[model samples]
Target chain A: MILKRVFLNRLSGTWMLITLVIILSLPLVIGIALYLKASPIFESQSLYQLIVSTDWSPCNGNFGFWPFIFSSLYVTVLSFLFAAPICLFAAIYLTQFSSKRLIQLMHPVIDILAGIPSVIYGMWGIIIIVPFVSDVLAPLINIKSSGYSILAGGIVLAVMCIPYMLNMLIETFNTVPIGLKEASLSLGATSWESVKHVVIKKSYPGIISSFGLGIAKAFGETLAVMMVVGNMVQLSFNPFEAGYPLPALIANNYGEMLSIPMYDSALMFAAFILLVVVLVINLVFRYFIHKTQSQ
Target chain B: MNKQKEIEELFFKFLSGFATYSLIAILGFIIIIIFVKGFGALSLDMIIKTPKGGYYYGGEGGVLNAIVGSLYIAFGATFIAILIGIPAALYINVHLVRYKRIQNTIRYFLDALWGIPSIVYGAFGFTLMLFLGMNASLLAGIITVAFLITPIIIRTFDEVLSTIPKGLHEASLALGSTRTEMAFKVMFKQGFSGFITAVLLAFGRGIGDAASILFTAGYTDLIPTHLDEPAATLPLAIFFQLSSPIPEVRERAYAAAAILTIIILIISLTARGFSKKYSKSNLK
Candidate 1:
């Protein structure tokens, strides 16, 4: 029995170690595979060439990613434009003026929004947002209704991102000391003045980190954006124009990529680019969270 | 100046308050649209039978294949995730608790893991499958999802485990118990409900996500009978239907979304209920 106990304990320890190894090494395996599969194309093309060129046609062996990259940036920026103020002020209101009851009520709603599948968000966008934009929104902006455009993608992304942004910002806002708010109020600063000058100022770094996280999320979204983003290869400043971002580019073409020469490598290259950008953002977000937590 | 400050305060106050409260309108609007449009699309066959005769092209049949596939992948992934996640959570909190920097470093990796996009996982899984010479299959989907949720499970479970009073751990150690024993018997007991909550949370995330499994799982017309075969999932179902040129099939996308939403709602509510019950009993 004693020997059995000893063996069991040792087995348990081994199991934990094995789990650790598996989790830690999965990323390495993925990274290496991405590098290997993408290197042939990488060797042929310079980073500068890839970033500057605008064409991405497989028939011509051209895989310029500038359009995809700019589309991603445009939509991400637009999503933040829609999401930031609403999320910021709402988070401020939530932490400052909201009652406990209201907070409790909002928790499940936000969780529900967060819990809803991304594709469902896509579904919603297709049914409601897409039509509204095509019929009403685009016409308002004097563009023909394409029903799928950067504006549609951006709006859907904002809804999807709001839950995450609010979660992060609310936590940051909550950490602002009550004493500071009280001190501001005692000095005759109004609630808005105190919140604007004190709470938001104090939590600016955290807010920026949260936005970084949101950008990572916005950049990586695939199914929802793919549905509404009207996956075309184009570089234009018009939000009404249909465009392809990196995730959409990868998703739309990865299946038939092997059918075309170098297409597999090109799509793999896209995935590699996305992974690097997102990882950097995530690392920045982690640093910000750690800094705030330490403070 | 005083009057201006007062006016500005009230204006900003109402604006911020409007921003805060507008979430209700937005959420309600989204859910209402799903229901109003999706209601016509739901039918008896949707829940019970597999798609028949090119349903993606607007034919007869249901999403039974996708439903089962999603369950198989999510449950399978969660099982693997729990096996690794619980052990990892306990290890970091127990074995490496004294080394705060190491723990934080480990946690930061996990955080980054969670933050990586589902599509990246899909792409990564696609690559991994190619390396193994494996076709897209239920097994591949499960493995990818296992990677997807490991960080979520670990982090949520860690939050619960970390909140356990230090006295409990010290007490267990004073009794000459091994840290492993303390983890399972004492800390596990204290964090039992949280484990449940964390599992459900991960499962909800797993089932809801389509991007990670999109390439790894591969769509099929029939329910997955074996882990070696490709399996369909609800999110992919919605995607296929929405992409179909047929308006009827397109409408079916909303029905699929409605069904997916209901499943997630049930999971969230159940998780909350169990956690609430445990919290009440945990008042001591």
Candidate 2:
């Protein structure tokens, strides 16, 4: 009976370890797979030329990713500008000034916002934000726009990211010890002063990491941003212009990629870029989080 | 000097409050808009009947195909995730309890995996299918989505398992139970409710996701009858329908969104309820 128990234990342990190995290597496998598939494009054009050129005539075999890359950066940065301050302040309010009951009430709201599918957010963007931008905001700013501009995408992306960023910021602030806050209060600091000085100072790494995570999320968001971001391949700095983001490029063209030479590879290269950038962002932030926690 | 500080504090406080309320308002607005627009287009026929010809041009039939397809994909993916995730999480927290560094490293990898965008997964899955001489189908989507949600399930379950007291492990081992036996019998029982919550959360994510399955799961108008058959999902359904210029098709998109939202809401609330009940039981 004892021998049987030992054998059974060994059997399950081996099974569990196999799964652990699979989980550990999954990211590496994906990264390698994407890189291999994308290598075909490199045979035709230098990586620098592919990324920097403005021409994007897929029919002519010229693939320039500059426009899509720029658009993605513009939309992501704009959304960060729109969302960061609000998320920071709201997180502060929830953690420092609000009652526990109020925080509890906000949980469901955050969950629902986070739970809504990206496509639904895209649909909402089409029905509301697109028209609002084209009719109201664009005219007020003296711009000719089709409403499917970087600004509309940024607004929609900002709202989608708020719940995610705010949740992280709130968790970060909660980790600031009560004793530290009380220490500031005892020194005759005002409540806001204590929060700004003690709580914020202590959780600075956490705040930066949360923002990093939020940027990574905004950068990779596809469906909603694709729906509203005009999907036009153009090199434009103007927020009111329709621009194509990298993910949007991939999502829009993957269906017909096989018909064109190097098109599938080009799209795969786009996915590779997204995968690398997101993983790097996550790795940097994870390192920061790990360093802080260990200290 | 004091007056300046007071004014600054008051202004910052007001800003914080404004931001908080605005966020709440946005959530409320989104929910209201989806329901209000979707209600008009929703009907029993829409829920029960598959789309007939001319559905995209706003003729007849319903998104029953999408509804059934989404359920099938979500269920299949979640089952696979749970199968892989539970064992991996259990191994980390139970079998590898002595190796804190290894546990944290594994967790770090999981976090990075969680942050990878679903669209990347779709692209990768497409490439994988091509290499394997496979076509887009239900099985392809299920495999892709399983990869997407497994990290979520493992991380959530790992977190819950970590909360189990160390003493219980010691006590179980003292009773001459093997480590594997203790992990499966003792620790698993203790964290069972949390495990359920984790599975439900992963299911919610899998069901709501569109990007990961977009390329792998070729869209069709019919419910998939076999693993090799192409399947339509609610999010893709909404995407295709909404993109149509026809007003009627667009309205149906809203209805589909509302239905998807309702299903997600149910899953999330149920998970919360389970966690709460588990916590209450612990308090006893």
Candidate 3:
């Protein structure tokens, strides 16, 4: 019985270790698989040409990702611009100024917002933001848009990102030692001054990481952005113009990809670009966070 | 100068408050719009019947196929995630208790995996499907979503397990229990509610995700009776239906969204409630 029990323990231990190795290698496996799938496009075109050229015709087997890359960057940056200030201010209000009761109440609100599926967000974007952008905002700016623009995508993405970024910011602010804030307060600084100088300063790394994570998220968002961004492949910096982001391009073209030569490769390459960008963003921010915390 | 500083503080405070309220208002707007628009089209028929002929063209039918398919995929994925995640989390906390470096390395990998977008998983799953000579089906969707949510499950369960005091580990081993026994018997029992919460949370995510299953889980009108059969998901249903030029079909999309939203809301609230109730009972 003793020998049997010992052997079973050993077996379970091996099982656990094997599972651990599998889990650990998953990201690498995914990266390699995507690279292999996307290698055909790389072989077909020079890396610079693939990324810098605007030609996207799949029938003639010419693929360039410049427009999609530009769109993803523009939308992500614009959404960050839209969401960061609001998230920062709202997080400050919740953590610094609000009572515990209010913070508690906001938890579920943020959770629900974050939990709502991207498709619902897309539907909401189509129903509300599209019309408002085309009829109201575009008219106000004297620009005619088809209601499906990068601006609409940005607004919807900003709303979707707000809860995520705010959650992180609130946690970051809350991590600021209360005594530090109190010390600033006792030094004749006003409450806002204490928060501005102490809390924000102390959590600066956290705020940066949160924004980085949020940008990574916004960059790879597919369905909602796909629904509103009009899927138009264009090299335009105009937020009111319809542009196809990388993930949107993949999601939109994957169905018909098998029917066309090099189409699947192009789409796979797009997915590869998304995965690498998001992973790099996460790694940088995580390293920043780890360095600050270690200090 | 002091008065100016005070005014500035109040003005900034007001701005912050405005920002906070606007976020809340946006949440309120999302819920209200979904429910109000969906309520008109929601019906017993919508929930109970599968899409009939011409359903995408505003024909009479429901999204029963998608609903059932979603539940099947989510439940299957959650089950797989639990099977892998629980053991993995337990192994990290119990078996490798002394190896902090390895634990952190493993955690870093999990975090990276967690950060990977679901679309990438969908793409990866598609590649895997092609390599394996498999068609898009319920099993493909389940496996794909399992990949997407397993990191979530492990991370959440790891957090819960980490919260248990260090003393429990030593105490259990002191009683001469093996690591596997201690993990399955002591730690698992203590964190059982948390395990439920983690599984539910993962299920909620799995069910709501559309991108991960978009290519792998081929859509069909009929409920999938076999693992290899195509399965429709609610999110994809809403996606397809909302894009239809037909008004009725678009309304059905809202109804589907509302249903998905309500399911997610319930899962999250239940997870919250479980965590709150059991967190107190666990040993500090």
Best by DockQ: 2
Stretches of model 3 off by over 4 angstroms after superposition: none
Per-residue lDDT for A169-272 in model 2, tens only?
Answer: 99899989999999999999999999999999999999999999999999999999999999998888889999899999988887799999999989999999
Real A-B contacts recovered, model 2:
0.74
lDDT of 1 by residue, A52-164 (tens): 88877877888799999999999999998999999988898889988899899888888888888889888889878889999998888788968899999999999999999
After superposition on all C-alphas, the RMSD of every candidate to the true structure, in Å, is 1.5, 1.1, 1.2
In order, the Cα lDDT scores of the candidates are: 0.87, 0.91, 0.90
Task: Tell me the spans in candidate 1 whose CA falls farther than 4 Å from its real position.
Answer: A1-3
True contacts kept of each: 0.68, 0.74, 0.70
Candidate 3 vs. true structure, TM-score: 0.98
Worst 10 contiguous positions by lDDT, candidate 2 chain A: A286-295
Docking quality of model 3: it rates as medium
Off by over 4 Å in 2: none
DockQ order of candidates, best first? 2, 3, 1
Q: In candidate 3 chain B, what residue range of length 10 has the lowest lDDT sum?
A: B103-112
What C-alpha lDDT does candidate 2 achieve relative to the native structure?
Answer: 0.91
Q: Candidate 1: interface RMSD in Å?
A: 1.3
